[model samples]
Target chain A: MDKVTNEMLMAFVDGELDPAMRKEVEAALRTDPDLRARAAVFEATRQPIASVFDPILNQPLSLPQEGLRDGTEQNRSAVYSPGNPHSRTPGIISWFSGLFQPPKTLSVTVAFCAVFLGGLGLGFLLKAGLVTIDTPEAGLVAFRDDGLVAAGSLDHTLEKYKSGSSFVKTVSDGRELAVKPILTFRDHEGRICREYEITYPATSRYAGLACRTEDGDWNVLIQSPIKSRPTNGKDTVVASGRDADTVDAVVERIIKGDALGSDQEALLMNKGWRGQD
Target chain B: MTEDIRERVIAFIPRLRRFAFSLTGDWDRMEELVQDTCERALTRHEQWKPGTSLESWMCRIAQNIWKDGLKSKKHRAQVSDDSLHFLTGVDGPREIEGRLTLKAVMAAISLLPPDQRIVIALVCIDERTYAETAEILDIPIGTVMSRLARARQALYAGLYDSDTSSACAKAEG
Candidate 1:
């Protein structure tokens, strides 16, 4: 017969062994002083470990305010927002169940970094009147200025471009900003929106959504920093970066339906950027 | 149904908080970690398969999120220092008493490395099966057993001397 190993004793102690093995171990332990001593040590250690931490199970904790949705309530109110604490933002996990409409164009430039969705430390691209220091909140999240120009550029690009054509525009500083339309779709609120990424190698890079207003002007709903890979270009620069959580929150909030298929996007473009227009 | 999930998630707060405390060993950071876990779980709740263990899924999310936080150099430094404080400097000299008190036991467990501590907490303290622990920590069951065995040995060495062991044997016998 093989000698009894410590692992077998542990398996016996932890009830991990099958019934035949357990019976064998029990019989072996009755005749073996060494195995019993080792088993006692294991039991002794296990008991104290439980006694030490089991008290924690009884300690009261401040309950979290919200819980996970089981996809039964797909259109439920958004309860989690990244930037604003008072307002509820959409649950990020809720996206996996086909609850939220996926964005048409997920920008390849912004590499996803892990960040807490609630306190998104935004790096804003400063343009004109949009730059302002945020009042310090309870958390240590820092908001930096470097984001609005990219946001505005994203808006303009969505308005001017057709389905297949690329958009290029000159800002006030004469820097050329190019926007490539990934796809266009109508949101849950019936707003016609286009998802695009603005790449200005010299100035900044941004990925955002541009929604058409009633008067046909484009408005940037959300924008975040683009992380350029080092191997792609030697001249790439990142002005500000958003974490994965913030990006997901933004997408969850604005998207209302599936991304437009190629044919659907082309048909919409032929009828003009807005089908009504 | 959403409300039921909300209640169930809320119920998990204590266990999550305790697990967080074990990882961080700081009450404030533990609470923050738990809060972050809840937020992440809610946001990504759609990804959770309906019939599987919710606790294990949430624990996996928490472990991954914490691992992500550890990627920052500053956070890694802080954790290193905290581990040293609890494991070596504070608890080493005082636990030589013949009896094993709760404080001594806790200090002994705290002396473990983070990975070992996590395995100990999941398997020994929380009474999770080895398979469940392996799933939660995203390690193999073999690794879990080895870490757990090492942790048990450390605890026994820390808490038991000849006098304590003889006394325990005497009382039990």
Candidate 2:
């Protein structure tokens, strides 16, 4: 007779055996104290693991946004409709929706403007510290008439540079916006999106992700605080959300597949994003 | 037809939430992962075969998202210290000595590698069969059995090992 291995014992504990094998194990256990004891241990081990975490089952999870739990396909489809900004196309929105998606309490700003930076004047103004963004708590950290200016510049730089490359260009205001490309990939929607770090002299530094919207302008997805540290005489940009795990988390959520290589990126840049078409 | 599938996916949310909590050990991240999994499952629900294991399918989606969102190879090693702290709080401080609090069990589960942890969550916690776990994890049945056995053995040692719990108790104290 084959000695009952731990695996077989576990199978018995889990009721995983057919009647013939189960009878065999039962017969073996009837005479073998050691095997029965071992089976008891395996069964005992499963109790805490299975039921210990059961409390969470009763602890009510705040339901997913209104549309998710309503049991209607229209509402469900709205959660990821192509036209919805919160599309889970590459499935990123679902991952960081808690952090990036604004709560119902705060009024969402949905201003769509078609403005392009044609010359260095906008860059100069952007460098001269004129842009201001409204903050609910801090009154106003920095306000820009158009949030798209800084986002657009970062987008342009990403188009021109490869991932892991950084360049500093002095604006007409004598200030520089250091643009560094960190990640570039197609989103769930098959649109090319890039994450970059931007440093504004005498202003603020930010890490942002911008996806190439159907229109020419990039849709600024989410911007989070970045902590800058001087490393080897160069500034190292560190994310400041969720213990600095935000960027990589966001990347993992939205990435459709492996990031685009240089050639693929160039091809994407030339053709532009069209929602997986 | 799509609405019917979405409705079924919604029914699985509570269990999915529990499974996500087991995997992430954080309330906020668990909710988000479940939400993401639901959205993805619905969006790609067309690919899912009808009359098959829907809950198992959703579990697979959640696991994939969790695996992808991990930051590094080390990130996949085990639950982090922060997560351990969070796990400890789940049962609160009212646990009597030697009674086997959920926190202690979670701590032990957290010590397993992420792969093993998922198997434990699906098989042991969610009560998925070995075949079903293999489907959710996309591993072979043999691999699921092997992993579960190792996970069970590790949990047994972690929970019953006097030295390990005493040390943990000291650290908590």
Candidate 3:
């Protein structure tokens, strides 16, 4: 074999050369003492240089001035909910949210009925299927698989909801919207709950509920969008905040807790949860 | 706007912070770098063109931000050559070679010429491939190989020279 070039040696060290080239390089290095020395030097040089810093992955993130100013707690809850209302992604979102101070306390009584909404989650190496988002500008409902669920997008399977006085809007076919009122009140365990239903458009859609905290941020409680308006017994129901059996159980939990009584509703209204749009 | 996209970016920040720290070697600065990079990635969503690797693109932005800000920090190097020598060399002292070998790596990187330093950070430490790195730096693929080789060599010399190799060895040990 002709003398192995330095490039070939380096490439071999890097595992960049194909099998035939690697075999040729290896055989030459074995026969020549000089080639073996050079290969060792190259390999030694390729070792990692230790850094001064230890793992800084969880160090406190520095909030930009704009992020601090714009991301008020109320605004965060008001706008950013990804996936659907019943989305399972809230845990991840909450994890991300805990990094910064909430802009305000929750005020669901003041929670406004209308505005733009969105959500999303992040991953270390993002794939095509996973959602991509920073802290959202709206109330977000996230799912375990890391997808965002939009608010108006879930208008089709409005049947599951039965709110007492809360406003509901669902796209019906192309031209119509099924509107209704909702009743959202805290149960005995202090978990606030909402019930409502809407008929959706032909397009796929999602839905969810948000409970505001005193800090002015909306803690996303439930995000469940309809995969299909279950035609009857034929549909399979995934267990979550939306499961028919669990819904009444949750409502009962909310009911027996006595937190959703008239006095708490007035308190929620004063805090901005009820008054919010 | 898709739910899928939102969640992915949110999940990415923690690891990205770690990578940025490895690149910049400063926790505060790394956080600032990551937040700005995320903001830029979101605002410039139109520029991303969709269907390409978002992590690489964000990583490229982070590399640029670190590079752009490096020139401004020239005045504040607190550690003396002796301290760095004691801190980074493979065998400066028995106490010096612990987890601090990681620090030695950062110190060596800081000492490198910017051209070599960046390639090392992006390709070697961050584990990005040459093709993705070339696209991030806007250099040719051949340049990635050349720069990476030189960076690796310079890193060995910078990190394991006689003054520091003893302490640096502790890191390897």
Per-residue lDDT tens digits of candidate 3, residues A190-225?
544444433233233334444434443334445444
lDDT of 3 at A226: 41
TM-score of chain A of 2: 0.40
Question: How well is each residue in A1-277 modelled by candidate 1, as lDDT tens digits?
Answer: 3777776777777888889998788777755667777876676666435533433433322111222223334333343332213223232223222222233311210111111111121121122221222111111122224222222334334543454455443222223445566567777777777766655644556666666666555555665656645535765555344334554456567777777777666445433344532
Residues A1-277, candidate 2, lDDT per residue (tens digit)?
A: 4888888889987889988998788778766767766775677566445544544443322212333323344543444421213233322222323222344511221110001111332233235443221121111122345454233335446555567766443332334445677778987887778887766763457777777655556666666766655556655544345224666678789989898887666444433333233
DockQ of 3: 0.09
Instruction: For each candidate in the order shown, give its overall lDDT on alpha carbons.
Output: 0.53, 0.59, 0.47
- lDDT of each residue in B9-82, candidate 1, tens digit only: 65565567557756665544665677788777777788878888888888887777766777763353133333
Model 1 TM-score, 2 decimals: 0.44
Better of 2 and 3 by lDDT: 2
Pairs with backbone N, CA or C atoms under 3 Å apart (clashes), candidate 2: A89-A188, A90-A188, A131-A143, A132-A142, A132-A143, A132-A144, A133-A142, A133-A143
How do all models score by TM-score?
Answer: 0.44, 0.48, 0.46
Cα displacement (Å) at residue B56, model 1 = 0.5
Could you say which candidate leads in TM-score?
2
Fraction of true A-B contacts recovered by candidate 1: 0.22
